[model samples]
Structures are given as C-alpha cells and as structure tokens.
Target: MSKVSLPRHVHRVVSRGREYFYYQERRGTLHAGERIRLPNDPQTPEFWNAVRQAQGTFGPTPTDTIGALIDAFEVSWATRQRKISKGTQEHYRRYLKPARKAWGDLPARELRPRHVDALIRKIGADKPGAANNILDALKAMVSWANGPVELLTHDPTQGVERFSKGEGHRPWTSQQLAFAEQVFTGTIRRFFFLSRYTGQRISDVVRLSPNDVDDGGFSLPQKKTGVKPWCPIFPELEAEMVTWERRPGPYLLQSSGKSAGKPFSTNQMWKAFDRERKKYSVLSGAVPHGLRANAVIRLRGEGYTALQISDMVGMSVEMVESYSRHADRKASGQAVLREFQERDASQIVKRLESGKRK
Candidate 1:
C-alpha cells in the first residue's frame, strides 16, 4: 500500500530497499516543509550528491530521521575503509554495531550533542576503556554527519574528555622470562623470542622472516598502520632470528613442513601463545601483546628515549604512549635519579677530603 503522505519536513529520506526518497523545497518553491521527492536510485550517484547538495541550500535541516543518520554513518565508514588498515576497519565496525538506533536507523542531520554525551556516559558505565574506544569511533561518524547545517549546530563528542590511564601493562618478571626461555624451544622460541626482542604484534611476528631480519636487524611493515618500515632486533634475539629462512608463502616460525608453509590465523597464534605464556607462571600475565610492552620496558631501562623506542618498534609516539605509562616507570625513574644523586654526593665528599689534606 503506497500511500502518498507528508509526515513532516520539506524533504523526507525514506530508505525502502534501494530507492531513497527525499522531498525538495527551494527558492521560489512552495512553503517551508513543502513535500518534494528527490531521486534515490542507486544507479545515479547524483542521488547521493543531491542529498549532500540539499543541506547547503537549507538553513537548518529539519529535525531529520535518526535511522537515516546511522545508515549514512555506515556508508561513510565503508568509504573510509579504502584508505585505512584492516585492523582499523574491524575496530570501526565494532563501534558501529552498537550505534544503531532502536529502530535500526539514525538520521545524520538530527543528532544532538546530548545524544552523543549520553551514549558516551552509558558506555563509560559499562566499561571505561571500551567507552573511550567507542567514543573515538562515534566521533568519526559525527564529523561526517556535520557537513551541513546553518544554525543549532553542535558536534557531539566535542569537549568530552577521553578516559585516562587505569592499569598498566603486566610484563613478565626476569624469573618468568628465564623460566620460559629454559622450557621453550624451536618455533615457540621464535614466537617468544620475537616478542621479547622486537616488541611486535603477534600478527607481525608470526609473519616475520629471514628477509625481514638482516644484519642482526629486522624490518617490516606494520599490519595495523599499513606502513612499510623496518625495526632493529634486540642483539640477544637478533643472533638467532637472522638465521631463519624466508618462505614463499606465510610464516617465519614453522611447526612442521605443512603448517609451516602457511600463516597461522590470528586466533590460532593467540591460542598457541597463551599456552606458552601460561606454562611458565600464571603471574607472568604476559599476553601476546604484553611481550611488546615488555620489550619497550627493557629498551627504556637500557637508556632508550621515546623517539628511539618508537622508531625501533615501528610505532608512533602517540600509539606507543601506552609504553611509557608503566607503573614501574615512575619508580624506575626515582631509583635512577637517587643512584646518580648519591654518586654526586660521594664525589663531592671525596673532593672535600682531598682539599683538607692539601
């Protein structure tokens, strides 16, 4: 039953199957909220352009449909996937899943700042870290949706402070590291050693090879950033990693002839790493990712600066900001300062004694 009815507004976006419907009201056109149907045929990309065009013409988009906004966000996200990494794409997808309205559609032009704030608050109540992750993703959507509007304009997630640190990385203790090293060998060693050395993501480590490791240094592109770059290996791990062969197909670390040739799925490698990590001590608390943080900790303790560590580990200063945030960093800092201060005091006392003797 296709009944011609004007619920409200000058233009209406009805997403029924492929054809989108929109009403038009222009200069020398009818009154405010006069019904006009614009083309939404998928064949004509102008249909999308027309909708984008309409916003510039109007003062404020009428209290638009919330359902329509959610759909628009999905479309914008798909467009962005062309330029970003797969990891980022998956992250945005997770955020978009919860952003759907109760009716399964949200209009872009109708969202208010309060709506975003409330969503952030609700997510925060559920889990603080997740709340921030979702907020970042939601903000990307808000930015796209704000292209139009004359007045009553407010961007959501604006002025909304993001969540700060909670707990820090749970790196393995020296004993745990020793114990794991003693018990593990072969392919497991390759995986474990790379984690200890390169501070690479598990996905990157498993895919690493002799070609990636050269002259006691390993270099590869980050799967997450899609950046092709190289990072040096820890001297201790480098000696072993440099000898491995680069396979034509998948992994650097191999189990046997068959599984060795193909790459391990992310989940598969995670499960395998978990088994190895748990074997030493439950207290090690080192996940596949925790190993990367541990490497950073070791590097910093050995007098590496943030920039040096970022370059060596193939991360941005911003992304590796988490690395500098260990609870022990402050404690470690104080200890180093105290040691130097005591050394200075001792030297001063020695000079005074020598002067008195003279």
Candidate 2:
C-alpha cells in the first residue's frame, strides 16, 4: 500500500481496500495515543467536523482551564455518553456554572488544596449544603479528568472536606399526611398514597405504569438506584387506584385534560403539586420527598427491622436507619418514661399501705 501524506495530527491507514483517517491530539492528555476515526474523505466538510468532534473542540477547548475541564466533562457525559440521569446531569451543570465563572479559566494543574479550601469557605457562607455539593461535583470531575479523560495527572479537589449538614429530609408526621390527604383528592391523592406506601421518590412515582403492578405486588426498577423494588401492594394503594373512574393511560397517575390519561411530566406534576400544597395550610418543613421518610418511619415503628425496610424501600440499611432515627429516639424516650412511671407507682403503693396501717 502506498503511503498517503496526511495533515499534522491526522493519520491515515488502509485496510480491506478502504482508507481511514484518525485524528489525535498532539498535546492534551486525552489526546495522547488516542485515535478517533474520521467519517470520510479528508477534503469533505464531514471529515473535518468529525475531526473537530473527535478532538472535542466543538465546545470550549478542554486544554488547560478548570472551566474547560468542566466543559469537557459535560460534553463527555451529558452530551456524548449520557451515563447519568438528566436530573443529575442538570445538577452537575448547576454546581459547575458558578465554579466556571470563578475559576474556569484557571489551570487545572495549578489548583491547590488552599484554593479548594478558600472556595469551600466562600460557598459555605451562604449555603453549607450547596457548598458540599459543589465540592462533590468538582471532585467527581477532577477524578474523571485524572482517570479516563487523562486531562490531569492529579485530582485538584482532593481532601476537600464536606460541610456538616444535619440529617436530610425531616420525617413527615401522621398529622401532616392527614392534612395533605384531606386537601388533595383524585390524582394528587392517589400519587401521594403511592409514594407513601411504596417509599419511592417522586421521580419514580410519576413514571409508574399499570404494567408495574402485578397479582401480588408493585414491582419496578427505581430510577436513581436502579434497584428493582418489589413491594407488596398495600391494601389502601390497591383500593385507591381500583376505585378511580378515569382510565389510566401511560402512567398510573394520569392527568385529566387534553392530554387525558397521559402521565404527568416530572416538572409539571411537581409544580402542580407544589401550587396546591401552598394553597393549603400543610405542615412546615414537610415535602413530597418526606413521604418516603414517613413510610420508613412507620415501618420501623411497626417492628420492621432496618434491613427489612431497606429491602422494601430499595434503600441501603444505613439510609433506612437514618430515616428511622427520629422514630427510634421517640421510642427510646417513651421507654425511659415508662421506667420512671413504674418507679412512681411503686412509691404510691408503699405510701397507700403505710397510711392504711396507720
């Protein structure tokens, strides 16, 4: 085969009587030893476009800046591979946006622990949880850069401590549930019942289908965890869905209107739920997500072990225990109060006997 002279950073090789072009980055870590095949003839627009994509130059050049690293990471995951959920990808973008404005142009290799410390302090002042989440996002990107992308030899966000936030999502009380139930009816009521009974997230609940139900139980793979939760359909949940007059279309919680029977989009459903919730005088600090905590707490109170709750809820044992912490504390306090009551009763009995003898 005759050697074809190619452009710098572009290599040509022939196999099976066809010519192929591959573009490699001359300087970038990800570029080193990586060959990205071009689509067609070198002179065509498609070929250059393919080369640009392979080089990852369609967006900001991911060469040196921390901002570019974030861009590259977004391109790789959000646009190209899409390995994470849309919500998670949006979260990453939200966290990275301010970071990009602050330090995007800074060299990733030059970032030090002190820089991370300063960033954390600055972000933590306004919102501690957000600061922690920012660090987590940066840490994840840095790790990806160091490993797969090969853009960095070292992680910049290493050893950055997460801000101490209290336990997440306060458990919903029975009174709160009752008030919300009284306020919500039909579709919203059914949705709330599904969430509480199944201990699933709102995202999963909105996506539930009739096919997700079975003869004995409700079974479906959770969106965030990918764990298939097979929960025995609670009697209340069964009755709630069975009695509904409107036929369910795509989702179990089908909305009525022009799109009748179709499932509610996550945002549309959440916004609607929120608007109605604000209308009613619901419990403070209670959210739809807290319903999951309520379920976990109720199950724990009913003598279900942490492990059992974890299995039913498709959560880790640690998470189940965490959600049950308030319930556990209440139980413990009651037990201690019982001990004092018993002691006081015995003292009363002794007093009564002495008085009778006198």
lDDT of 2 at 20: 75
Give per-residue CA lDDT, model 1, range 1-358, as digits (tens). Answer: 1323222233445465454476555524455544445664422223444454455544433224443454444444434425667677677668766665432334544555677767777878868788788778777756656654222245756777667746555677677678767777766777788778888888788777666756657778777767654576656775765665645644444465566556776677887777776665543566667777788777777777778888888877755666766634786789999999999999889988989632
Candidate 2 is scored at a TM of 0.75
Candidate 2: tens digits of C-alpha lDDT, residues 114-160: 88888888989888989988888888788777875588898667677
Best by lDDT: 2
Model 2 regions more than 4 Å off: 1-62, 74-87, 245-259, 354-358
TM value for model 1: 0.68
User: Can you tell me which runs of candidate 1 are displaced by over 4 Å?
Assistant: 1-82, 101-103, 148-153, 214-216, 242-247, 252-261, 280-284, 319-321, 325-358
Root-mean-square deviation of Cα positions for candidate 2 versus the true structure, in angstroms:
8.6
Q: Which ten residues in a row have the lowest lDDT in candidate 2?
A: 40-49
